[model samples]
Target: MNTSLKTILTASVASLFPLGAAQASEPATSGQPDTVLIQAKKISAPNVDGTSQAAALSASSDSAALLRDVPGVSLYGAGGVSSLPAIHGLADDRLRTQVDGMNLISACANHMNPPLSYIDPSHIGSIQVLNGIGPVSNGGDSIGGTIRVNSPDPEFAMAGEMLRKGQAGAFYRSNGHAHGVNLNATHASDAWSINYAGSLSEAGNIVAASPFKVVSQGNGGKPGLAGDVIGSSAYKSENQSLQMAIRNASQLLELKLGLQNIPYQGFPNQRMDMTGNRSEQLNLRYKGDYAWGQLEARLYHEHTRHSMNFGDDKQFWYGNAPGMPMDTEGKNSGTLLRAGLPLSERDQLNLGIEYQRYRMNDWWSASGTGMMMAPGTFVNIADGQRDRFGMFVEWEANWNPNWFSQIGLRAERVSMNSGPVAGYNAMAYGNPASPLSVPGAFNAANRQRADHNLDFTAVARYTPDSSFSIDGGYAMKTRSPNLYERYTWATSNTMVMNMNNWYGDGNGYAGNLNLKPEIAHTLSATFDWHSANPDQWQFKIAPYYTDVHDYIDAVPCSAASKICPGRKDGFLNLSLSNQNARLYGMDVSASALLLSTEKYGQFLGNAVLNFLHARNKDTGSGLYNIMPLNAKLSLTQHLGHWNTTAEIQMAAAKTDISAVRREMTTPGYTLLNLRSSYTWKQWRFDAGIDNLFNRFYRNPLGGAYLGQGATMGQGVPSGIVVPGMGRSLYAGMQLKF
Candidate 1:
């Protein structure tokens, strides 16, 4: 490694340590440098201050929390630190998450660790969410949008002269017992910089609602919402990140690597005796100034290994879940490269190429691992893999100083290899009476393959002046059948119902080798107006419509018992499907500096409103689990050494739940949060209370899953509801030398 690179890595590593203990005596003049503000795209937003002033307050926030304030954005908060950002009524695989221009897919099926889990909040230098009008350099097929998180990268004029030498800092935070410590640090030199961040959170029964109450027909057919088993329900999750960058007169290069591991004793759905996951990622990039304009290039690779098991004690309780008996493993790998160049004063170009692969395996233990079935009874229902490669290019030319048009095209090639892997299908036959009832042995020779995919997009923007602009675009996108959607033949416990459900098979769920990718054509427009002087005020409004063909939905199949005569209750099953969908929605957001310190008391106020309306013609039901109209308001007071903030959030009632499933309506509810900090020059103390009111209400989607017995004669309903959290408190302190 080059000495500069070594120095870079070292600085980032040091940031991982607890540096608050070290003091230089005098207060550091500069805390963090100001970043070049990118136009706040609806897709990505980065919060610089400790509080989420410009965004909606979130219970669980990752690097992408900055965009919560953007119009038409909602987050699925699974825990206190894990969340998935949704945009324009789209989320999950539709939205892409990038760290330093790299993608790190979480390994868990429940999505415990989303894109934001890879970095520590303290180490983030800046974040940008390209909610709408996504830059072509980010590639295509992102219906929701993309989020970008950049580390500390700065340039010095003298090259070797240090107008101000960037220094390193670190801090650690720990909660009560079972709570693990989190550490992070960073250092910046005149020409380059490095940073490291990590966290270890081990907690038992995350403090639940006080005097908790249970509904008679709550989750898992359990009597009452059982008080957490305290020590029995425990979890441990950790993340470590290392990043280094070199900056010269006109060039910049960076490399990043990261790893994370998580293990838990019990989760809500699963009978959970134990479950764990491991993930890794690496990325590299180079950027330099060219005579015509600027040039940027980047490459990345990522892999994730996920293994989970339900202890024997409870393994038999939940029927036919995939990877049951504690030995299921899933893997994913991908690589991507992107480049951009400014062709001329009035034109620019961005292009990218990317590849991705995914695989899953199910094996039984050799020893008597508590299974009634024979040992070593391994079955490979998902002997499937997909290789997807895509290249996209965009050209931008200004018709006038204030008006410009952008056109983009993307071509993709997707090759799939799917079928039984020799002994894979035959083994499942042993379970003649179980849901693992394979129709018949499939020959490895019966494998199938498919190829060819292309997408297109065109956009135009007109800016009459610095204060007003409007933009819109048209795009066509497609999605192929995933491994689980096509080749899965075994029972799984990870779907809407916690049963040994088959994704698709000869039964109600049939695989269509001839299935075509879902195609969508979309169009949208945005209007923005802003004023920076005097009291700051900015506002943006967007409207969009999309029509999709061959859209897939997991509709009910034939009776599960009909396929497998020996099976008990009809097992849950779905097949390769298609439908037609048309959607339209609007997003509006605005922010203003209600008060300025120079003219009035040291106080600030901000508020945001987010709304969405979606429909599914196939089901004639509103998009499943779509959040209704919601809004958040916050106020902050700043004094010499103290800053205090309070926030209120409101969620509107929602009547949209998939039919076969009775939609549980969520009455409107309100929540309050408070936080404050005292800064004494080099050191700062922080504290906050979440859900200060201890209000009790369940999220519209909480446990809103199809129950295993919904198809049985049992009185159980189609969807189950999980309650939200009660009041909670947290505090931390930071120091700078």
Candidate 2:
């Protein structure tokens, strides 16, 4: 159960068995810059000079699931498909996740299309995660971290025709009744070739704690959210994607298109059922090698439309009590472009610019008694034609091969102009002008505004030789306040109380339209080492820290405050103007070849461990969502065309870092996963099981809700604090013609 015991057992036992070893071998060629490439049989990514950056790379059963394995990254899920990954306790618009150079920002107040949501994990070739202020070329909005997902590249281009000339492959995997499929095709003809990929998946209700009990009413007893839990809730989702690529030795071009549709019925989260929530994305890119250096260009666009409706289902309860009916629709869209060109041999540069827009319009049709409260509300809160333009540049210089440095800068301007958000007060409470008091009334106003910010980053890399290297970086960036934080006008729902204050509920709430952007400064360092013949041993370690200023926080306000509803203790437009925070962590990765032979194939053993800590500078309290110390042991074996692998991952018990704000605590847990694959002639097949033991445990977020013991399954809480998936199995295959 302890880290030392687990490590000793994994190394001593797993290393002795070929089935528990990785198939590590020398690279086919030398002189390549990536001399210490960490090529585990199951996952592939550029090893920063023999240093393995832990990234959860796999056919994502769900995009957010992939980030769970990455150190310092955690997802806030309401126990289902609507999960959003948070980094270093930062999420929503705070972190940036890009795919093939394209950015995917979310538009939902509840955060539906978080960066990862648009990506189909199975379609990704590799993933790279920079814990904090990684590469400026990756772009800067990461006060927490940044993740880059790369699509599978052409394989035949490097190995040649004998290995795989005209090969086509397909894969299918199912877990707990949710099934996924992938189809891939590749062709090579001496120089010019093409690769294509497509994937689709569907899932059903997730099972959670069942028949749990609690006191229904609050008096002298613990105030619980639900009196007694019924049958556990279920979640369902479907996603699909397509990618086409044209590449040669000197040039490459790729076109990617994806569509995802999720409609949940009887699931947790909202009172109204998610009717038709769909997302569409299109991306294109071109890269080539030039005599001077290299040049690459990219363009991308995405659209998301979400709708909600409440029918005869009694599940549509209001304020934790049976009440009104509701319905609405929302949408968001954007476009971006980036280009990189080397200016000189010792200096390389990248430039990027982008434009984006967002809008939301919703109509509600409430009937019967609830209709009388707020009839036919045409609730429209749109940032009509909101615009943003940004320009960024990165320069890399080599002070010989032993030392190099890179610096990046970005400037952006944003403008928002739309009508004021209008909705019924919903609660009659005390005001005669409240939306509930005056039914079918339009109370919110129209609006418009503009804002701009500048971002900066710099990094230095030192490599004394091919076997060892070190890197350090620093950055400064800013993020504008979101529209909802500034202009939302609605009476607070007394049922959903804020844990921070205990009474900031239905009394009355107001918005602040004058909030400024949050700013951040970060510093990071990494060290890497590898033997000349790494087929034997290698080691890598990275430590990082970040300091953020003007950190945003929400608090309750008294009705006497400057903002409206000053006399009531509720969620008014209260903000922390000058706040700061810091986060630090270390990640270590090491591998040793246990056995290697041409006849028996190769066997290698590897492990990765990480520890992270973060705190609010203002309160010296623990930051939210920081992952606990954890480690993973993996073994891969190869026998000609047959291969097998197994891994054991462990998480240490966690103590709350964010004090006062109760965080969910998890007990140390160990999990075992097994995988095997075979190749016959021109065809290949793979199969694996995740969480083989079907263990059950709740994450920090899920635990936080249980602690609240209030109206939990509402807009903010929404079962997001429940445990994740249990034991699951999957299999896939590919063929060559």
The whole-model lDDT of each prediction reads 0.52, 0.52
- Candidate 2 lDDT, 1-737, residue by residue in tens: 34465455445543444233222322211101122123221111112223221112123356566545444556665424456666556776676677656666655433444566665554555556654455544545446556666666544455444323333333444443555555555565445455555555554444333323343343234332342231123334555555566677688887777777766432233323345567777777788887765666666777777654332222334443343333323344445555556676677677777665555443333433442335434333444445667788877788697878877788877776545333333443223244333112223323456767778877777776555666777778777655545544333333211211211111222334555677888776666555555455656666766677877654333321223223232122332233577767776776767777888877777777877787777777776566688887877676787667788988887775554333445677788888777667655666777787877655444432222223323323322344545666766655556
Question: Per-residue lDDT of 244-329 in model 1, one digit per residue for the tens?
Answer: 77887678888878787766434433222346566677777778776655666666666655554542222223333333443445
Model 2 earns a TM-score of 0.75
- Model 1 scores a C-alpha lDDT of 0.52
